[model samples]
Every structure is written in structure tokens, then in C-alpha cells.
Target: MSSTHNQEKLKELLTQYYLNTNEKMVFLNKKGQVIALNEAAEEVFSEDNDYSQMTHAICRRCEGYSNEFDLMSCENCFLEALEVGNGSFQVFMRTKDDKIEPFTASYEVIDKTKEIYAFTLHNVSPQIERQDRRYQRLMMQKTISAQENERKRISRELHDGIVQELINVDVELRLLKYQQDKDELIDNSKRIEGLMSRLIDDVRNLSVELRPSSLDDLGLDAAFRSYFKQFEKNYGMHIVYHTDFSSQRFDSEIETVIYRVVQEAMFNALKYAQVDTVYISLYQGEASIIAEVSDQGIGFKLGDKAKGTGLGLFGMNERAELVNGSVNIDSQVGRGTIVTLEVPITDKR
Candidate 1:
């Protein structure tokens, strides 16, 4: 066929494909004015009865600009970048249903002599929602795993520590009954008394580990002070602590959740940060309580694969959520890490 006839045939084929495709497509001029749109684009604007009168209308459906520029401004728009052949980027736009949704957009100069550009959009909201659901399910599983591990630890402590001590005392008492000399019997009785004292200490330690009695009796402030002191003594790590809500009290559930999250954050720093000193601060907001723990030690990337099982961070988040709270973690690879927990003072139950 002749060159003119071949060009006409190619245009017809392109027009047929554009009309039959499901994706939204439109043509615009260099000044960002709409020239023409395909049937899929027409249906989207039809929901608002805007298709017939949309000639040369500036596309205001953009929800926000990309992160590289002002979030909601039109400056440096993708259309402007078409002069340099910038082809594709992601954007959020307001749909006919009045919802701001994400779309993968592609822009290209279809007519170089006239400076006309073609823009195509593909909806991506369903894929984003599916990923969020998967993350939430994984977090729930991690929380359950952490609880089970804690239960096993407590059980092992009782069986191996206290129960074995009791057996030793029983044997010592039986030996006392078989002693012939009075002096020998007295020595055996003294040894039994020593074992009983050690057994009592073990029980108290276990009770504190499960749930400190001071937390219920004195409140969060007093409990934290005592816990921090013990932590320093045990691990030889110093914690610079400060608090403004010294005598204030909150709902029991809120107090417990905050305490547990802070405890876990501190443990994570001790195990991974490898720092000698840490800082902790607590204060009350208008309707919430905020606690922060930070350490100047080795940190890790936000989305990088974790070195450990990572259940500690998951457990901290789960505990906070139990009381209508949130946990925020910030870290840099060579800098440090900070964990903040905020819980509303309202009744969560």
C-alpha cells in the first residue's frame, strides 16, 4: 500500500484499541488542557455529569502532588516534566465516587509537532488494601507467640528453681531425724534454715517478674522508679530517668500497658543497642500519657530484615493497642533508636 494509506490504517487501529481498552486514557496540550479522552475516561467523568462540558478543563482531580514537591500544590506537575520525556509516576486522585485513590499514571508526548501528551491511569487501591491486611495478620500472630513464650519462661523458673529447692529441704529434714549426736542435729537444722531463706527469695523474685506488686499498690511512677533501679543493678547499665506525673494515676489497664511497653523497649535496647547509657521520660498530656525510651547505640534500617525474631517490637505495639494506644519507633543504622508509646487515659474495656 502507499505511505499515506498505511498511515491512515495505523491511526484507525490505534483509535479502535483506545476505545476498547479498560484503562482510563486522555490527551492534553502542553498547557495542561484536556483535548480528548477515551470511552473509559468518559464513563468516569459521567458519574458527575462532567464529560460533555469537560473540554479544555484543567485536571483538578489530583489529590496531592508527589512527595518530592509540596504535597498538595500543582507546581512541578508531571505534565510539566513531559518536556524532558519523564514518562511515568504514581499519583493519588479524587475519583467520581468522591474518594481519594491511588493510580499508576503514565505521561508521554504523542504528537511532537503539536506538543500534545497522552496520560493513562491504572487503579491500585485494591492491591494496597490487600498488603495492609496481610501485615495486620502477621502482627497478631507475633503477639500470640510472645505471650506463649513468656508463659513457658515462668513455668520453667518455678519447676527448676523453687521446686528443686523444696526437694533439697525435704532431704535435709530427713537427715536430721537420723542424727545421733545433738551437735550434729543442730548443724543439720541450721543448714535447713538457710535453704528455706533462699527459697523464699526465689518465690518473691518470680512474683515480681510476673507482675510487680508495687505497680498495683503505688502506681506507675513508683513502680517505674523501682524497676529502673533494679535494672541498673542487675545489668550494670545506667538509665537517666525523668517524669512529671509523679503522683498522678490512670486507669489500671492503661497503666499496665504503658509499663509493659516501656519495659520491652528498654530490654530491646539492652540486648541490641550495646550502649552503656539510656534515657527514659514520662509525662501526661491533656488526655493521654506519653513515655519515651532512647539509646545512643547501634541501630538498624526501618524495613531491613531483623537480626532477631522481632517479637519484642511486635509485643510492644500489641500491648499499647490493648489500651487504645500507639507505638512509634525511629532509628538510623549508625545513629541511634527511639521508641515512643502514647496511651489515651480513657477506659479501653
Candidate 2:
């Protein structure tokens, strides 16, 4: 075959490959004229794409752009860097529908003398959205942890210091009642005793909410028993708590994370599941300590718009990760949701 015929055939083959590929591709001249566009690019940019106006139109609709980044079209503008043959990185672009979409784009300068550039647009919107959500979850988890730590500090102060002072005052009032003959003093002493009793209960409840003393004092088994009993009473949700973790002492952090994750999962069940029963189980399985919180409530669609801030599941996952654990949630529309967390047990002994 002649050299010119071979070149033409090679061009046809390359054209067929690109047209068949799923990604969108477009070629533009230095003066910003649309020289060629593949089928997908034609659909996205539209058949009647006004090259003159749409050339820089993308800059106006893109997100996370700043003048400091020199991002008029894309951050690096790979088409402009074709001379160096370095592919520019992830860039956000605007669709014809005015929606900002993410793309992993690259450009190759075909002819330096002619200034012709061929660009490829790989749709990465789904991946970018997933990454952004993961970041948001991490931030929310840190915020929740900080808030809980603050509450714990305050609860400890109230339980150890302020409540003790109140108790002392009540004791003094009783002593005064015994020393005085006035009926008014005796009545005041009774009122003070009642107030002190209520205050003590509040203190204990606050402390438990912050850091369950039972978990610290007794361990996960006893702590869970008290927690579930109270959960059933408060939420009217019957939780069938089962455990084969007899006398198992988990690392303090591991125990706390597991307990809190189960607690949140239960709360999610009550708030969204709408069922009356949640089954919880914990035991040593293989090299990990596994905790499962399953509820027979109305389930939810994963990755759908959450009823609330959507942080419940996110928080649970974060807590599990803190102890080298993993959380899995399974649910459908009518079926109940099951949240499972598995933490690798360390052989510290």
C-alpha cells in the first residue's frame, strides 16, 4: 500500500476506536472552533453547540474554581499543556443542562504547527460524589466525637463535684432538723432531701450518657444489660439482647466504640425502622469481636436521601473504624435493616 493510503487507513481505525469507546471526546482548534466531536460529546454538548460562545462558557458553570488556580476552563487546562505532553488532572465541567459534572479529562496536541488539540472527557461524577460524601462523613464523625468528649467532661464534673456538694448540703440540713425543734425546719429538711434525691438521679443519668460507668466498672456484658433494659423502657422498643461474650474484657476503646455503634443503630431503628423489636448479639468469631444490631423495622434504600441529616450510619461507621473495625448495613424497603460491626481483637495479653 502507498504511504498516504496507509495513513488514511490508520486515521479511520483510530476514529472507529474513539467513536466506539464510552467516554466523550472532542477536538478544538486554537481559535476555539469545534473541529470534531464524538457521539457522546455531541449528545452532551448538543448538536447545535455554539463553539464561539461555549468555548469559555464552561468556566462560568464549573464549581471549586478560583482565579488563583488559573482555572478558566479547567485547573490545569491540559489542552494548553499539550506542548509538554503532560496530562492535566481531574477537572469539573459544566453540562449543557447547567449542571456541574466532574470529569477526568486529558488532551493531546496532535499537530504543534497547526495547534490542533484532541481532548477526552471521562465522566467521573459518581466517583467524585462518593469521595465527597466520604469526606463529609469523616468531618461529621470528628464533630460528634468532640461533642461527646465535651459532654463527658461536663457530666463527670457534675457527678463528682457538684452533686457531692448538694449531698453534703442535704446532710447538713438533716443535722439542723435534728438539732432544731421548729416544725418549719423539719419540713424544709424533707424538701431538701427530695431535691437531693432527684439531683442524684440526674447526675447518674448524665454520667451514663457520657461514658457508661457500668462499662468501665463492670465491662461490656453488664454495661449492655443495663443499657438495653433502659433502651426498652425509654423507647418502647423491645430489644432481644444475646451475648456469648462471658467475662470477655475488650480494650476500653474497642468496647466503647462497639457499644456506641450498637446504641446508635438501635436509635436509628426506633427513629426510622418503625419496628418494635431489635435483636443484638455479640461474641468472639474467628479473630474478631462481632456485634450485630438487627431490627425488624421499615428498612431504607441505601444512598437515598436520608430522613434526617444522614449522619447516623456515617457516625456508626466512623466509630467502628476507630477500633480497626468494619460496619455493614443491609436493608430493603420492607425488610428491616441489619448493622454489623466487626473489630479485630488484639492479643494484648
Candidate 3:
């Protein structure tokens, strides 16, 4: 073939394939009525379409835009508000399946003389679903990591702290068997008895740290009281606590998740906030349970390098999410840090 013929053939193929892809291209008049559309749009929207539906001045399948007030609302509708050429947003639209899904939409006046525009859509719901899946995987991985780390710490504590003391007591008891002095034997026996009491206390403390008995038997209100006393004694720091909550019980899952998140928040403050005192507020809102942990200390900026594993914050957020809740952290360089958690009361049942 001649060179000119080859160029014409290339253009033909380009025209043939360009309009048949996954993208939906729609041409609209000034009235927002669909004037023309590509093969892809036709394939996607043809099943439920009728003659009047096609010709009537209707927004081409657009539902609404997501705003701060609502996820999808006709408030400040895009049809009336799409500017001349600077219109681009995430829009919800009804697809071929008659299901609403999100899409990246762009509107531009392609022909100013006729006041005609081109509206395009690229479905974003698939991408959003993929992102959600990835986040869930990350959450699961981190949860497992946290569990293993806790188990290892507990195992090491048992082997080193209590087990070592027990071994020393065992040696003393065996030596007592060979001792000739009655008073020396009695003294050693009493010493061994003291060691056994301490060992029992250590095991009980470990068990409580793993899962506070008050959390299950009583409620979060009681659990926090017990936890804070131990926290102050163990870390030499005070928690100025206030509560507007009572002893009413919640779903075990909700109570447990909130308890763990609060525990982690306080632990983070103790480890990094560089303060002698922390403030905590627990309350029951109209539809949610809320907790706030605050500290006036040498605060660090967010997105800066974390002093610790950095997974603590993410883990807290993830755990809160599991119970239909949220965790918000606010901090500044020299001011202070506050961690807030909210769980909906709908989950209380």
C-alpha cells in the first residue's frame, strides 16, 4: 500500500477502537440532554433506556455529588452548577445494573458556539473497593502482629520474672531439707512462702493486663478506675479522670474494643507525651460512647517520624473501626496531644 493509504488505515483503526473502551463519553446540549454517546456508554446504558428518557433534558445517569453534609445528595446539584470548563468531581451515577456507583466525572464545553459540552465518566467504585480490601488486609496483618508481640512479652515475663524467683525459692527449700537448725529452717520456709505470694500476685497482674476482669464483670466505667490506679502505681504518672458514664453494660465487643483503644492511647501518651499527668474523659453521648485522652506536654507533630513502632496509632484506628467507631489524634509541635475515640451506641445492643 501507498504511504498515504497506510496513514488513512491507521486513522480508521484509531477511530474504530477509541470509542469502544471502558470509558463512557457523552455529548450534551446546553440543557444537559444527552445528544450523543460512544459505544461504551450505549452498551452500559441501553438496557433500561427509552425514547423519552433519551430525548428528555435529563442528567445522563448522574445521581449526585458527595459533600460534607451527605454522602450523595442533590444539594447544590452539579447539573445546575457545572461551570463552563472547570467541572470535575467524584459523582454517583446509576449504572447498567441500575445500581448506584461512584465515578470520576468531567464536564467541559466542547463547542462554545452551540453551548454543547462533553461529559465523561470513569467508574471509581472498583478502585475504591480495591482500596478497602487492601486496608482490611493491612488491619488483619497488624492485629496478628500485635497479638504475637503481646504473647511473646507475657511469655518472657513469666520465664524471667516469676519463674526465676520460683527457682530460687526451690533451691532454698531443698537446702532447708539438709539444714540442722530448726529456727533457720522455719525462717527459710517463711521466706519461700513470701516468694510464693509475690509470684501469685505477678500472675494475677499479668492476667488482668491481658483482659481486665472488671471490664467483663462490671463495665468500662469500673475497668477504667481499676486500670488508672494500676497505671499510676506502675508508671509514676497520674491520670486525672472524669466520667459521665454509669455501670450499664454494652455489647462485649464494643466494650472490649473501646477499652483496648483507650488503653493504647494512654500508653502512647505515657511513652511519648513527656508529661507527668494525663487527662481522660469518658462519657455517653446521645448515640455514641466517647473517650478523650489529653496531655499538656512536649507534643510531636503528626506525620513526623514516630518514636515507636508507629503501628500503635494505626492499630488503634483499626480496632476502633472493627466496632463501628473512630479514633482521632490531634497534636502539635510544642502545644499538646489529644486522642479521641467514639463508638456508636447502635452497637450497644
Candidate 4:
């Protein structure tokens, strides 16, 4: 059969199947115009019988979106599929009754010659709920994994660089106390003393990983600069940093969340992007603070399973949401990865 014929047959079959649905069903045109809906769908998206007035009401209520950016509707809007003429997706939606529900939706071009398209949403509340639970569990695991990785990194840095250097310094100082050929050995001892002092400073700097005093004492800008310096020094990755936030101290939780997210994103960039350079931008808007990290290197597939624990992205997202913020990652194979996080901020008054 012709593709056109097949589509019509499929639509009819879908309509018949959907008529028996206990959940909501909605159909939209390419312009987000509500064309058809089952009884459940009508009641969910509209309060009255005038379904035409509903338009993309359901799309507007979708919960998943890139908080880092301003979006008119959920990123999962069926119109996104309509744009391409053959994409389908599902997402959580908040109904007109203020109840959250899930729907399985698809959009396809019905008549390419006439530019007519159809978007269908089948009530998939059960499936969506199940998937959401799975997502949460995955996120929790990610957070735990990230914490462990951090501990290991700090431990190694201290053991290899700081602790070992201190040991050598201690031995040198002991020799200085024992062997003094008076004026002859004084300069050599002084030079060793200078090296030991610098080593002490380095160890002190390494301790910043445990808890950056700069975050509380100097605020985010200073803290980030210090952290980025250490990131470059230790990981050998260069970061292009930019900031435009008002020099105001945030709640401790917000500060820590932002710091950790940036830290994670940079690490991911270094590991996956294979690029030597990372870009970071921080700016505050009227109601939200935004952080963006981008890297130009070998990009991996989005939604693809991460080779390791896959907790890095998950942890970053959880931290963002902890502060009522949202995280978005945009990446494509061979293009690069961009992570943007936004958190709501209130005036201290």
C-alpha cells in the first residue's frame, strides 16, 4: 500500500483503539491546534466542550524543559516532532485540573503535498509513572557515585602531591638541623628551607578541595577562579571563564550546588569531550541565576548510556533541582556538549 494509505489506516485504527481508553487522548495539527480528542483528553486539557479553544494547552503544561533557557512550552511538545514530520515522544503533563499526568505522544506528517500533519497523544500515565520512578532511582545512584569519585580524587591528590612533598620537606629540615658547616652550608640550607616553605603553601592549597573557604569568604566569583585554577593545574584543561552576577552572597546551599555542578560539568567535559578547553559562563537574571559550560570536542550521543556509572550527568541535574533549578545538556556526536543550569534566586531584601 502507498504510505499515504497506510497512514490513514493507522489513524483510523488508533482512533478506534483510543476510543476505549480510560486515560486522556489528544490530537493536534502541526500548528499546535487541537484537532481531535477523546472524552478523557477533552476533560483533561479543557474545562468546557469547546476543544478548539484549548489549542496547545496540554503542551504548555508539560513539566520537562531546559531551565537554563526560557522556553514557551515543554521541550517535549509534540510540535517538535511535527517540525521534523516524523518524531514521537512522551512526557509528563499537568492538566487543567492541576493534576500531573503522563501521555505517550507522536506526530507525523499525513500529507506532505498539503503540509497537513497530525499529532497524537495516548494516555500513558502508567508507563510514564513507572519510567519516572526509574529515573529518580538512577539519579540517586548518580549522586552517590559522584560523591565517591570526589573523595577518591581528593585522597589521591593529598597522598601523591601534598603528603609525599611534606615528607620530603620534613627529612630535609631534619638534615638542616644536624649538618651545619657554618657559613659554607648556610646558602644550601636556606635554599632547601625556601623549597619547604613553598611545599607547605602547595599543601595548604590542596586542602581547599575539602571545603573551599573562598566560597564563603570571597563569594562565587573568587571561589570559581580559585577552583578553576586548580582544575587547570591538576587536570591540565584550560577554561574560559565569564561572569556577570551581582557581587552578592547566596544561601550556602545555593553556593555549594552551583559550585558542585560546575565542577562536575567541567570534569565531564575533560573526560568525554577530549578537548583541552572548557567554557564557563555565570550570570544572574531578574529571578534566576544561570551557569553554562560548553566544550568543543568529541561529543557523545545524548540519552546514550554513559560508559562508566553514568552518574556525572545525573548528579549535576539533581544538584540543580535541589535549588529549584533546572539543568539542560545539548550535545551531538562530533559536535560537543553544552550543559546549562539555572536556579531561581530571590532578592534578600
Candidate 5:
């Protein structure tokens, strides 16, 4: 009798320390009823709540558990599948604040004869969020790389093969003008030459629009200059360009992302902003490259109804994520708009 009493005292003393710890520990019976819980667990779940609500504390908090086939499924519950031993799995639970979130849970049989089990929950929401961001960044990089490579190949084909062929046709049409003395033939030759000239210009413009060779050969600084020249001619809206980034080269992917983001910002301003002029700034920060596009045009509320399909801003953000970068847009109704992109410098300094 003294031995059993001493053992019970020892258990009480040890539980006193465990009950006060930060780790949430809960006990369950074989029927999945809550038997006991530590102080930490009490904060996460209710111990004294009755089954008048047709639920136990564990069932009230637990939404579902993860299995091999499903992210969160209630079909095969962890309580039923859990053997009389140790096991770990992800479980989604409703917290005290009533938010459904993920928790890394472990279950084990604490007393085999009594069929009592221990269940512990460690919140893993933050870790899952970080992991998701990492995966998105990686996927964005690969997708952009593939797109740029294909664009480069198609651009070269149009500029070299198709443009050259069209130019030769222009020369032939011009030669036909002098070869014929008949008024009818001369008129036909003149019209054909005019058509060929326009066609050649269109092809050249399309090639450059697809992918500028200057971007590949010279770098972002030169490429932006060339693109802006075309931009001004096409839109008649001037861009007051400012740059601290000279001919400095970066990784091809970074350059592409920057150029594409800047290009989209300008187009968004042109399409929506009721202004004729925009300001673009490109520079290198401590260990990052930054670009800003601003305009004193008619800006709209950020969360107001979108002017277009709403995919333009989304695409810019997705592109920035490729380099572990970010895009921030600031705008206010009746004021102006500013879009900024910042990407870290990785190699190719």
C-alpha cells in the first residue's frame, strides 16, 4: 500500500510540471472521449464542456486529419486509424479564436491496459506558408525561363529569315518600277512596292516586340532605352527615364523579369491613367535591382472595381516572385499611381 501511494505521489508531482509547460498535451479514451488535458491544452480546448452540444472537446476543435490520399479528410479519422502506438500526422483544428488552421499532431498510447492515449498538437501554419512561397518562386523561375527561350528563338526567325525575304521582295518590286515603261505596269509596281515596305516594317516591329535581341546582347539598360524609344513612337506618351543602372548586366532571368514588369506598368498607365507622361526610374540598391514607374494620372482606388480583367497586376506580381522579388502598387483616386519592383541581386554582379 505504501509503494502504490508513493507511485501515485510521484505521478502527481511529474504531472504538475508537465501541466504547466507550453506544450499542449491531451488525453483520450478508446472511445475518443477526452479523459484529461494539461493547462496548455485547456487553453486550446474546453475540458469541462458537456456533450449537450453533441460533441466532445476533441471533436469540437478537430476539423479533419491528413492522410496519404487527401490533404484533410474526415472519412478515415485519425482516432480510428491510429493504432495502439506512436503516430504522427497533420491535423486541421479550430483554435480558441475559431480559426481553422493546420497543426502537426502526434498520438501515442500512454496506458495500454486502460486504453488511454496522448495527443499533442504543434501549430505549423507559419512553416507551411513559407514552404508554399518557396515552391511558387521555384515554379515561376522555370516557367519564365522556358517562355523567354522560346521567344528568343521565334524572334530570331522572324528578324532573320522572314524579314530578309520581305526585304528582297521590296527590292524586286522597286526594280520592277524602272523595268516597265507602260503606265499600267508602273502603277502596279509602285503599289506593290508600297505594300511590301509596310509589310516589311510590320514584320520587323513584330520581331522586336516578341523579344528584342538588344536585351540579349547589350543588357537591360540598353534594352530599356531601345524599347522606350519604340514605346514613345507608338503611344506618343513620353517616359521621362531616370537610371543609375548603366550597362551593368544581371542574370538573364532577372533582366527579363525587370523588363517585362516595367513594360507592363507602362502599358497599364497608358491604358488606364488619363495622363500623357510617365516617370520610370531604374537603379541598383545595396544588393538588389529596383525599378519604379509613376504617373500623375487619374489613379483609381486600389480595391475598387478593376478597369480591365484584373490579371495585369496579378501577372506583374507573379513575375516578380520568379526572382524572390515583389511588386508594390500605390494609387489613390484623383491622385496618381506608382508601381515599384525590387529583385535581389544573385550572381552576375
Candidate 6:
């Protein structure tokens, strides 16, 4: 074949590919006027029937969000930013059938002489929904695992700590019954009393660890203050605690979720961070209650293998989601770690 004929055939092949591709492709001028569009784009904005009539500023079919802002909004409109050469962005747009959807979009200058640009969009709503569903399932599994583990822990505490102590006390009492000397009998009685006291304290501590009654009786602030004091004494770590809610109360579920997440974060810091001091802040935002636990200690890489079971972080996320909340963990090696939990609160009192 002649070179001229081969060139013509190649042009025809390119035209066919452009017209048949599923991706929505459009060519626009510097003025944001639609210069031309492929068959996929034609179907998306079929209301116009004529491509020449479609301009980005007035297109109704593309109503959605770009750069976390409504696409129609004048501020940070991705189309407008094309004149200044911006990067690819995620966009959610209403389809021709009126269903809102997500798309990954890219725009680039195609003809500098004419100030023309090519805009491409790839539909990603299905992939996003699938990922979200998978995440929710994983979270549910983690939550169930955490509950089971906690039950096992409480069972162990009752069986090993309290029950064993009671058995020892029983043996001591049996020895007291056989004692002949009054002084020895008195010493045995004192030993049994001390054992009983220690057992009582252990049971109380176990109960608190399972679920602190103060959480339900006095609200989150009181529970946190009491817990922090005990934590400091146990770990010899100094905690700087601050809170804005004096006596303000929230839905029980929200309060519990926030308190538990913060508590878990604090424990993680103490176990891993090697820091002597930690900071905890609790406050109410406009629509959410926020708890932040931070430490200026040795932090680990965010995605590296965990030193511990790693369920603490997962449980925090699961609990936060139960209350329509979120947990964010930020850490860098040798810098620090900050765990923040934000839960939406509907103030009941």
C-alpha cells in the first residue's frame, strides 16, 4: 500500500476508536465552550442533542462536586482552573438518567495555539461503593472479635484473680480452725483479712476495666479524669488532660464510644511510645464531640507491621463507626503520634 493510503487508513482507525470508547471525552476552548465530544460524551449530555450548545458553565447534566466543592459553584470550579493548568481531580456528577455518580477526571491542554483542552472522565462510582461495602464488613468482623476477646479477658480475671484469692483465703481459714495458740490464731486472722481486702480491690479494678460505672453515672468527663489518674499512677506517665464540657451530657452511645476510643489510644501510647508525658483534649465542635490523644514520643511508621496485636486501633475505628464517628491516627517515626476521634452528638440534656 502507498504511504498516503496507509496514513488515511490509520486516521480512520483513530476516528473509530474515539467514537466507540466508553470514556466520556470532550474538547473545550479556553472560554470553557464545548468544541467537540465523543459518542460517550454525546450520550451523557443528550439533552442538548447538538454538542455546540453545551458549555461547561451552563451544563445541567454534569451537576456534581469537584475538589470537594459543588461543580457549579464559582469557587474552585475545575473547568475554570483548566486555564491555569491544574491536575486530575475526582468529580461526582449526575448522569443523564439523573443518578448521581463519581468519576475520576483529567484535563490537559491539547492545542496550545488554539487554547484548546481535552477533558476525560472515567466512572468510578461502582468501584467506590464496592470498596465501602468491603470496609464495613471488615469493621463488623473486627467489632465482633473485640467483643469476644473482652469477654474472655473478664472471664479470666474472675476465674484466676478473684477465684484463686478466695481459695487461698479458704485454706487460711481452715488452718486457723486447727490453731491452738491464741497469738498464732490472731496472726492467721489478720493474714486472712489482708487477703480478703486485696481480693476485693482486684475485683473492683476488674469491674472498672470491663466497664466503669462512672461512665454511666457521672458522664464522660468524670470517667476520663478518674481513669487518667489511675493510668498515671499505674504507668508512671504524666498526662495533661483538658476538657471543655464541664457537665454537658450527650447520648449515652456517643459518650461511651468517645471515651473508649480515647482510652484505647492512651493505652497504646503508654505501651509503645516510650514517652513520659501525653496530652489529651476533649471539646465539643459545632456538630461533633472531639477527643484527641497525642504523645511526643517515638512513633512508628503508619503502615508498618504493628508491635502489638493491632486490634486496639481497629477496635477504636469500629466503635467510632457505631456512633457515626471517625478515628484518625497520624504518626511519623521519631516525631509523634496523634489519635483523634470525632463523634456526632445530639445533646439530650
Report the number of the highest-TM-score candidate.
6
Winner on TM-score (4 vs 6): 6
Q: What is the Cα-based TM-score of model 6?
A: 0.82
TM-score of each: 0.73, 0.55, 0.80, 0.63, 0.54, 0.82
lDDT of candidate 2 over 1-349, digit per residue (tens): 8999999999999989888987888776776566777888754566575664556433443463223334554545444445433544566667778777777766677788998777677788788789999988787786787678768888777867777768777687757746656786777777777777767766676667668989988888899998888777767888898888667787889889888998888888888888888999998887999999998778888878877766677778878889889999888888888899999997632
What's the C-alpha lDDT at position 246 in model 5?
Answer: 81
Candidate 5 residue-wise lDDT, 1-349, digit = tens? 6999999999998888677666678877777777667777765676556422333456777888876646755566666666512557888888777789888788888798998888888778899999999978866776687578768977777787677767777777667756646886767776777767767766666767778899999999899998898889888999899998688999999999999999989989999998999999999999999999999999988878777656578779989999999999999888899999999999994
**For each candidate, how many residue pairs have backbone atoms clashing (under 3 Å)?**
0, 0, 0, 0, 0, 0
Worst 10 residues of 3 by lDDT: 50-59
For model 2, the local distance difference test gives: 0.76
Model 5 regions more than 4 Å off: 1-179, 182-194
- 61-83 per-residue lDDT for model 1 (tens digits): 77644544235446666555554
Residue runs of model 2 more than 4 Å from their true location after superposition? 1-188
How good is model 1 by TM-score?
0.73
Query: Candidate 4, residues 1-349: lDDT per residue as tens digits?
Result: 8999999999999778788766565655545566766766664666464656656554566774222234325444445634533444555567777886655655577666755555455567677678889988877776777778878988887788778877877877777777758875686677777777877777767667667999988788899998898888878899899998646888888888998898888878887788999999999888888999999889888768886787777678778888888899899888898999998985442
Q: Which scores better on TM-score, 2 or 6?
A: 6
Please give the CA lDDT of all the candidate structures. 0.81, 0.76, 0.81, 0.74, 0.81, 0.82
Candidate 3 C-alpha lDDT tens digits along 1-349: 8999999999999677657667877777876667777777764456347522454333556677765445665666666666623756787777677788887777787799998877777788879999999988887887788789989999999999989988988898888889889998888889989999988878878888989999999999999998898889889999999998777889999999888888988999888889999999999888899999999988887778877667899878878999889888899877889999999976454
Query: Global lDDT for candidate 4?
Result: 0.74
Q: Which scores better on lDDT, 1 or 6?
A: 6
